[model samples]
Target: MTKVKIASTTDVSSDKVLKTSANGKSVLVAKVGDNYCAIANKCPHFGLPLAKGKFENGVITCPFHGSKFEICTGKNVEWVDSFVGIPLPAIAQKMIAMGKSPTDVANFAVTQEGTDLFIDS
Candidate 1:
């Protein structure tokens, strides 16, 4: 397993997101209590960095297209109850479900350990 020591537990506060990049892909680090949770850094919609997006109730919205996703899994928040791989007529819907209108996910690998993060292939 690959591990990157990002920061200490004190560096982040509960409910706040600390974003960084590893392996050229966006990495989002969030502090919940004394532990850190890491996930993909970019929004599933429009490929916007999740760091630039807003977080609320464990969910985040893409700034580029108003698409929302769950911060932990990078999956669509499902406001309209749509599937990730499905395409809708609404542009905003597509963004939320697929991260971009033309949803072709560039797969990457990432993980976290003891407040540190790692990006592996």
Candidate 2:
């Protein structure tokens, strides 16, 4: 478990992204109040760079498809049995191996100390 310094407290503003490295993997950090939170920079749903998106009420909305995801939870904004409810414009995709879901493949984490954020790859 490696911890990398991604940004200085003065660098990222609340609701912004700061890229970091922990265990040789790219991670995304976001400002929440006076503290910072980190998560995988790649979107679990579409593998997009979440750093280019916006954060609102602890959730980050993907710019590519406007899909909302919980930064702290790393889960889709809404769901019911492997289905997405949001109508945001999205790219067509090959379905997940039937019955399976995106949540099955996502394993993002968020941690912080003061204004510094950390992630585990």
Candidate 3:
């Protein structure tokens, strides 16, 4: 695997996420406590950019469909439960999901060197 420098330590905080590219692949970098985490920047639900989503407590909520994912592990916490930040009914959510099952985003290994952070892509 090749290590690609994605961001600097100052570029991300615990409450914020940085959207960058790793070897031409969209990557989301977040600082969780003292550790750094990196995941695919695209939402698995609709291929939407996760950079515009909300990040809190090591989880990211997709803005378009409200799919929640764990940034560190890229695990799907909730899937397609809302639209444009508004909660949707179960029936409506199912319809909006369009038979697509919940999927986890891709995660990459992050290595920190001084103020710079690199991801194994």
Supply candidate 3's per-residue lDDT for 3: 84
List runs of model 3 lying over 4 Å from the truth: none
Answer with 2 or 3, whichever has the higher lDDT. 3
Query: Candidate 2 residues 35-120, lDDT tens each?
Result: 56667777666576767766777777666545566665566763222224234222232232233244411435555567654555
Cα RMSDs of all predictions?
6.3, 5.2, 0.8
Compose the digit string of candidate 3's lDDT tens values, residues 3-120.
Answer: 8899999898899899899889999999898899999989998899999899999999999999999999999999999999999999999999999999999998899899999988
- Candidate with more favorable, higher lDDT: 1 or 2: 2
Instruction: Compute the lDDT for candidate 2.
Output: 0.58
| Candidate 1 colliding pairs | 26-41, 44-99, 45-99, 46-99
Candidate 2 stretches with Cα past 4 Å from truth are 79-117
**TM-scores for every predicted model:** 0.59, 0.62, 0.96
Clashes of each: 4, 0, 0
Candidate 1: C-alpha RMSD after superposition: 6.3
Against the unseen true structure, what C-alpha lDDT does each candidate score?
Answer: 0.54, 0.58, 0.93
Q: Which ten residues in a row have the lowest lDDT in candidate 3?
A: 112-121
- Stretches of model 1 off by over 4 angstroms after superposition: 33-35, 79-121
lDDT of 1 by residue, 21-85 (tens): 66565666665444455667654444556567667766665554555665555566543233343
Candidates in descending TM-score order = 3, 2, 1
